[model samples]
Target: MWNKRRRHFESYPEIVIVHVSGYGRPESGGDPKKCKRGCYDIISQAYSGWCKLASTPEHEVYRLPLYAGNYVTALFGAMEMLVAYIHAQKTGEGQVVDVAQFEAIARIIEMYYTQCIITLEY
Candidate 1:
């Protein structure tokens, strides 16, 4: 007989967990060099597309005021996790995961390619 992992909580509920627990320097105001080109725009489009595809009912979703805000939150969350993992691996205190901005953006557009390929088949 196979054993299954125990559920953390009974009656599992759907939720969006944005994990942003890690250390890093916050961006200073009006810093041009601190910003990355086209990254913000890409993330915004990805986030909006994600929200649109979410299974939750419209009434239950909390839409962000601006797509830029969503992008920043997602970017920060990814950075936090990546930094923590890197710190841990170097010091033998944590695991490291390499998440490049370009790769992440490419993953977000996987469906776009699928759509392009599939639509032509019809």
Candidate 2:
């Protein structure tokens, strides 16, 4: 796959690219407008499909628990894409913009970890 893409890029004098990684590309991934708890849970849950907020076909919003950093990251990613798009339009160049689900969680976790480490001294 890499070789094929490299060959294709040979045609362009110097083409720019924008890359992202996640459950799937934002285009292939579900719509961000109406994202749900299920979408976020896919990555947040250590055990996949293990602890789900009880909801029926007619979901009762009041019953839903807020296990939702995934949604926050998804929305943040969309915002980043908008900025990247504007940059590309103005400069006529593109760049890679990766937003991995686990990676985003890891970042948040590390910040928390740092706090724990700091408290250890006290």
Candidate 3:
């Protein structure tokens, strides 16, 4: 469907498409079965290691109830869409923005961990 629409890019050059997926680009290389599987908030959380961030004192990992992975993906997607929109407006060329939920969650998790380490008391 997107491939077909891409063919008409010249017709609508200002189009800024934002695609949000659970894993990532289907062709980016990974388990083919996982690429085809339907995604949920919890699935992305687990895949991105977001669940591991919320462990008990015993270190038993668990998922958060706030759907942080899903929300983060959406926030990232919206930001990308805005950037793409700006580019389209300037160049009169359309662009596709792909936001992976797992990667998005991983990004935030990495940032948080980095900050924690930076502020860690010696």
lDDT values, one for every candidate: 0.40, 0.48, 0.78
The top-ranked prediction according to lDDT is 3
Taking the tens digit of each residue's C-alpha lDDT, what string does model 1 give over 16-99?
222221121122222254233344444544433433333245444333345544455567557767676566556644332333
List the candidate 3 regions with Cα displacement exceeding 4 Å. 27-33, 112-122
Task: Give per-model CA RMSD.
Answer: 15.9, 10.1, 3.5
Q: For candidate 1, report its TM-score.
A: 0.29
Q: Comparing candidate 1 with candidate 3, which one achieves the higher TM-score?
A: 3
Deviation (Å) of 86 in candidate 1: 8.7
Q: Report the C-alpha lDDT of model 2 over 62-108, residue by residue, as the tens digit.
A: 22246555664576577667887787678765544555454454554
State the number of backbone clashes in model 2.
0
Native-to-model Cα distance after best TM-score fit, residue 31 in candidate 3, in Å: 5.8
Tell me which of candidates 1 and 3 scores higher on lDDT: 3
